[model samples]
Target chain A: MNAIQIRTMAKDFILKEFLPGERPENLTDSTELITDGILDSLATLKLVAYLEKSCGIEIAPDELVPENLNSITQIANFVQSKQAST
Target chain B: MTVAALHEYLEQSARRYPQRCAAVEASSGRQITYGELDALSDQVRDHLRRIGVRPADRVGICLPKSIASLAVLFGILKVGAAYVPVDSLAPPARNAFIFNDCGVRAIFVEASRAETLRCELARLAAEPCLLPLDWSDGPSPLATYLARVEADGLAVDESARPGPDNLAYVLYTSGSTGQPKGVMLTHRNGSSYVDWCSDILAPDENDRFSSHAPFHFDLSILDIFVPLKHGATVFLIGEELGKNPTRMASVIAERRLTVWYSTPSVLTLLVEHGRLDARDDHALRFILFAGEVFPVKHLRRLKAVVPRARYLNLYGPTETNVCTYYEIPQTIAEDRSAPFPIGRACSHVKARVIDANGRDVPRGQEGELAISGAPVMLGYWNMPERTSAAFHVDSSGRWYRTGDVVIEGDGGVYTFRGRRDRMVKRRGYRIELGEIETALYRHPAISEVAAIARSEESGVSIKVFYASRDGHALSLIELKRFCAHNLPAYMAPDWFSHQQLLPKTSTDKIDYQHLMRME
Candidate 1:
């Protein structure tokens, strides 16, 4: 999938799973999920699982930093990079 | 120097190690020495006094975990007042309820949250004075307030200092009722636990402790105070880094943290996602876990990676504060599946297993665990009836009912069976299913609701089953929003199931067992 499609899918999953009842408009692509307390440790792992399974990219243990998963755009970028390397 | 109050630990440490690092922000690498922390807290105490705060008063702290917030906490205690810390990330309404329930005269909060919290408090009858922790615009910030008071050069009133019996802090826990209840802890109660930990851990000024738990959690009691009592440094793990296991692992190695205390879930995350096997430069000497049971599988794996560190399982409710502890053996058999026992009572406290009649149960029999000692809280905040009901009085002494069912194993070791009440531990936070149900009942559309907790491999997940009043379908988003507004995020239900009618027993009570079976 393209970068836009990846961002849309991840955002949709996060909205449906973690931030139910939250307005989609409120969650910008650059919104800091971990810092804003929207996603906790468990939720972060779940999001990682979704990305690895759906995007067909393996995430290394060291790659689980905030720079890669803190925002929807960051997640999409990380996923694209992983896909490109593979 | 003899320590009479909780803040005295910091004072004594400052006198001994003025230039030693006392606190460090893990994310930003900010450091504060003992002298700075002591003087900063003194400024906060002066600011509080200028605002007419006195001994026995309640002050609320709603800021994130940082060195500044820690100073504010010690300042509140120095003024002989109890500090009530609410979750900065929780709903404003919940925080407002806690402030009102405790009748806080003043609150130190983030400037961004001050307006919303002020509006929520306005809805209630009480209007607490809000002192923003940080601000660029609007009301004067805490720094400005403290600086103005410092310029006045007012001397602290030593006569108004708190005694050992005076309250140090009030931590609110989930109540079966819709509202939360504050557990009132005094200087004596806090000192008992801290002294016990210090004696056993034998920490020195060179030790670095990781402050992984939030300020509001009971685990933070050890994270902040124990190290201060020994002139050690506490590394404040910020919220963003706290959720990232990779970053947490890196912080442990990079900062060379010698002491670590947190829930089992956090440690599990580190073991699974942190790549612990890759690093070997850890300076850890003690690893303590509490709040919930640590799975044996994860514990085995963790011990394999960091075999040199001593592991301990500390057990207690917030009302008791580390009344019991167990030292894990160096080796576990590969076939072992059952979790280790909670072990015996701590040196400062006496723990016993009693039957329904409050009489001591025979050895090896299951009974409720009751603790009696200096570590037990004085009582719930302003809740005389609850305080009385929570304890059992006899000729021996008063004992606080823990509501935890356990069995006495070999050699006085107590093995946890389950909770006698509807309370369940999720990620080390005690949650009452009834509280979730009560929050859901507040929604106008929810006619009947029952909340239940299911133990999963990841941890406990709360599922709420509800039926609408008009038989019309309710949106999941709306119900979830309603719950988020009323309860803390941890207490929010993970799943919401719509039912035409909730199953009930012949006595008209909801059949919780039936719902569990369905799941």
Candidate 2:
């Protein structure tokens, strides 16, 4: 899947799992996803799991951060980076 | 004055907020006013009275997070009896040891945990278990009991109540020592700790704190009671956080919560996936955590949004309530390192790093962390020898040894390194492998079980090595998930490994050394 597709999937997962009430159809304002308390620290695991299975990219425990997980867009970029590194 | 009393905090809250909301379920929207809480507690005491429960008796409160659970806790204390909170979320074996070790007279259980509790109760050497939950249409059994108790209007015999020196509750054994050992605490122990901690928190009557952690975990000490004591409202988060984070975030914002306390593992859920920052209402004023080390990266992310909120690191085991605390410096989150310092001891609690010979080590020298103060538990229940060994005494009885390795840096700052024993802290829950296995042995699964702490998060969790009886089959996930239902969430093993044969050590013991080898 391309970055757009990955971002779309990530957004859908977050909306379904976390932001069920605020189903923001668009991830254009990526910051909106996190700043609103729609996701949290435990969601880190789900994001990591999704990235690995969807993009076949492995994320080290140390590499975990909000930058790589702020929104679907950033997580997709992270998968791209990890894929490139391997 | 006895440490066993739970009435002090309750009476204080009742007096302060006779009509103000004291507790609210964030998801269910159920509410409990302070006056109602007081009345409910009276009902709990009355119910216990009907059961022939008396002073210093232990009552096993096996239930989930709700107003009823909180009422039972206070009710037990009101009668000078210590309430043993059992997390219905953990494995049956763990809960069994807790109920049995404490010699619990009666256990108040819900239908959800009826099977697990019934199974464990059957194995208990001898103790009558009562299902307090009533599925009847009229009134909740707990509520009915409380109402009858309230009708008696039994103003607890204040003069007869135990004082500061008495045992408030016995935090039962977890992890290794196989059978759970009760960590004896006093009314004074908890009150003193909460007194100092409350002043530090300065919760106003209007602030809504989250009671998301399990009642069994020590974290519940603060989450369930502190706010009520100060007339601050407490909001109970639905158990939904386990499977969903987005719902949790909505609850946090909707409730207008001011203070939150939970393990870093729970927080990681909100920040990493819930995308909590986008909310308009940021009522959160403080974040207090213990149970496990908070990852620096996560801390940095938390600070980015709630930059002004005070984030604190509370350290200690169930035995010592909380021995040390660190007020997170806003800047340190960004300029951090691995294995961050656990911080200095709390007021009234003293810390001394001691060497192998039990002598005080020099500053910055790593030694077993020995804490002596009001918060240190009286001793382990039923094991005078183990108690004596755990609580060391000198020519003068001045110090208590905390089996933790630490470096007492200059100016009394202490840095936590690792454990001095095989004990581990996962997600802030202490696990002694011996404790989990003790519970496992009760199961008719046939063969053996070994619980180990593989990671910090895997604290108190076991990797069972067992051979099931004919027609018995358990998958790793199913076994672990089963364990989760029986044991407290933290006490439950994270990963399960089944082997055809058990590994043996040179001494002919089941080789825990080989089992600990990372899978």
Candidate 3:
């Protein structure tokens, strides 16, 4: 999938799973997810599981930092980079 | 050496191991020796006294977990005042209620949170004195007060020495009522639990303990004091770091933490995402888990990865401290699905599984567990009715009802059955379902609500079934935001379901069993 497609999918999953009532327009690509407490430890883990299974990417323990999963843009970029390397 | 007050542990440790490292901030790599910790707390104590804080007063601490906060805790104890710690991340309104309920004379808060908390307390009739721990925009910082006290050369006030019965701290827990109730713990109550754990754990000066629990949590009592009593090092784990399993695992390996204590959920996360098998440099000797049951499968995996570490399951409410403990044995049958038992009572306390009539239940039968001994809390703060109702005063002795039903097994071992009340444990936090209902009732759109907790694969998740007053569905985002503003993040409901009418029993009560079936 393209970067835009990846971002859209991840954002949709986050909204449906973590923020059930949140509007799609509210979560911008650059919205702070981890830092803003939108996703807690449990939610973050679940998101990671979704990304790994759906995108067919392996996430190392060190890659679980906020730098990679803090926002939709960051998550898309991280996934793209992993796909490119593979 | 006898220690009457909790702060005396620091005093004794400073004398014995003056130059030994006492605390470490794991994220920032900040370290404080025992001598420095003691001296810093002395400065804080003098500053508190100069600000008109007297013995038996209550002081509120609203700072993130850090070595500096540890010094403030000791300072509060040194003044013979009980410290009330509120979650720095909790809503300002919730914290304001606690500060008001306990009548805290002064609050030491982080500079960033000071303005928000000050504004919240503005609505209270008697506002507490706000002392910012760091640099603030308005009021002079705590450093300034400490500096002024240091320059004045104030003599130590021996008169402020507290007896063993004096209040040490008040830990607030969720109450069935909308308001949170404070569990009052005295010096003896804290020391007894610490002494018992220290004896069993036998941590030495070389041991390094991880302070994973927040200062507001009851688990912090053992995390901070147990290490100080033994002159060991306590590495403070920040909230963010604590949430990241990979980083938490690395911290354990990098810091060479010997004694690790936290809720089982954290450990489960570590087992799932931490990649523990890759790191062999960890010096973990004891791994302690409490609050919720560890799924047997995950526990087996954790044991396989860190086979050398002694695993223990501790059991207690904030009111009773760590009254019962079970040490995990070397091996478990592969097909075992049941979680390990909570084990026998600690040597310092007595545990009895009593029936509804307060009589001891027969072995293999289930009843409420009652604890009576030194570690039992003094009572709920300022709530005589609750304090009296929580205990059974028979000729045998006063026993605090745990509100947890447990079955008596062989050799006096107690196995946890379930809670007798609406209280539920999620991520090591005790949340009262009624508290959520009460908060939701305040919302104009919500007419009737019932909160129920269901055990999910991840853990406990609360579901709130509500009926709207106007026969219209409320926006879920708005409802979530409403809960966020009034309650702590953990206490907020995970799911909101709207129903036209809630099911009721013949007794005219909400049918909770029917709701569970719906789930």
Candidate 4:
């Protein structure tokens, strides 16, 4: 999938799974997910599992840091990099 | 074996291994040697006694985690006074309640918090003398106070020496009635568990332990005392790094921590956010967890990361100080759905699942878990009625009712089912649902209220559903603000829902399960 498609898919998955009660309008493309407490430790793992299963991308241990998975845009970029490198 | 007095352990260890580093504050990298810990604690004890601190009296320690805090703790025990720890992060009102309820005569606070301590003391009905410790600044007010005392030739009283039965510390836990209840633990109550830890973890002078849990929490006892007893080094993780998983993993790697103990929530955070598995360092050998259930999936994943590290799940409330433990198997089957067993009882403790009649339940049946052990707390501090209600006496001995439901498994093992009361462990804090409800009830507009813990795969957070009184319209923001004023940040409900009428059962009692499902 393209970068835009990846971002859209990741954002939709996050809204549906990690933040079911959150409003889509309240979240920006760069809104911090981990630091803002939107995705706690458990939710972060669930999101990782979702990305690996749906997007067919393997998240390395180093990539699990907040800089990579902190926001929808960050996650999309990380996924795009992983996809391109693979 | 009867151990020496708790403070004497530090003295003895200092004599045994004076050159070994005793502790390190992670932020500043300041280290305390065993010899300094012994001598400094003696100095603090003399200072405390000079200030009329008598045996059996309560002394409050209200400083951030540092060398001074540890010295004050050992000094309190040295003088035979029960040290009451109040988390500086908690609201002043909560700290005030603990100080008042425990009737502390004096408190040791950080220099930065001297004014806040003064204000809190002023609000109390009785005043507690404040002794400030300056870790950053030189010649603080506390240093001046000590110098003045010395110059005046004030003689220290060396009369009191605490024995096993003497109160070591009183940790305050969340109470259902909105007031915090102090769990009075004696020196014996702690040493009993420390002795067991000595055998289980088997640390030596070479070992370095990571102190992650906050002082107010019971898990801290293991982090602080266990290492001191063995003449090992303790790496103190500050609150900021303790909450952040990436920093936590980095510290463990840098310090080469051999023994790691914390709540499963912290481990889950490190495993996910920090990718704690990525570290190739091999210092960690023992991984101990308590305070909440470790999700099997996370445990399995962590096991994969540190395959050589031995994993153990310890089970008990603050009252019993860990009477049962389960060593996680090397591999958990992918098809297994049940939570791992809580394993067998710890040394010197008896654990059983009993029915309503206090008799052991049949195999595979669910019942309340009761612990009878030497490590059982003396009782709730100054609250006889609550203490009596928490324990049951029979021909055997006093059994502390855990209020936890467990199902018996084969080979004398038990699997945790759930708690029988409103108490729930969220973010590793044992919070009472009634406590949150009481906080919400303090809001004048709240009429009917119910609080429930919502658990997801990651962790648990509380949600409260409430209705305003007649003709009162209460907004969620206003209610949250009210709760913030009365409750600790962790005790405040994460989500709030407004309702015209709270759902009730046929008997007209609030249906908590229904409320839990509502969110």
TM-score of chain B of each: 0.96, 0.87, 0.96, 0.94
Clashes of each: 0, 66, 0, 0
lDDT of 1 at B239: 74
- What DockQ does each listed candidate score? 0.23, 0.03, 0.31, 0.07
Question: Which digits, one per residue and each the tens of the lDDT, describe model 2 over residues B391-450?
Answer: 667764556677888888766878888887877776666777675676556666646667
Writing each residue's lDDT as its tens digit, candidate 3 over B39-135 gives 8788788778878899999999998888778888998999889999999989888999899999999999997898988888988865788877674
Model 4 in CAPRI terms: which quality? incorrect
Candidate numbers, best TM-score first, in rank order = 3, 1, 4, 2
Model 4's TM-score against the true structure: 0.84
Q: How far is candidate 1 from the true structure (C-alpha RMSD, Å)?
A: 3.7
* Error at B80, model 3, angstroms: 1.1
lDDT of 1 by residue, B367-443 (tens): 99999999899999889999999999898899999999999988889999999989999989999888888888888
lDDT of each: 0.87, 0.70, 0.88, 0.82
For candidate 4, the iRMS in Å is: 6.5
Q: Candidate 2's error at B280, in angstroms?
A: 4.4
Ranking of candidates on lDDT, top first = 3, 1, 4, 2
List runs of model 2 lying over 4 Å from the truth.
A1-86, B1-4, B111-131, B135-141, B145-160, B241-243, B333-335, B396-398, B436-489, B495-519
Candidate 4 Cα errors over 4 Å, as ranges: A1-86, B135-159, B469-481
Worst 10 residues of 3 chain B by lDDT: B135-144
Query: What tens digits encode model 4's per-residue C-alpha lDDT throughout B1-519?
Result: 346467766877898999899999876688889987776677677888878998999999888887778888988888889899988867677888899889999999887787776787688765898887775665233344456556543434452567888899999999998889999999888988888999999899899999998899999989988899889999988765676676688888888989999999888888877768789895999999998888888888888888888999998899988888999888889987567878888977988878877887888999988999789999998899999999878898889999999987888788888988889998778999898888778777889888888777767877778888883445433454566567775676767677889999999999876876774
- Which prediction has the highest lDDT against the true structure? 3
- Poorest 10 consecutive residues of model 2 chain A by lDDT? A32-41
Best by TM-score, which number? Answer: 3
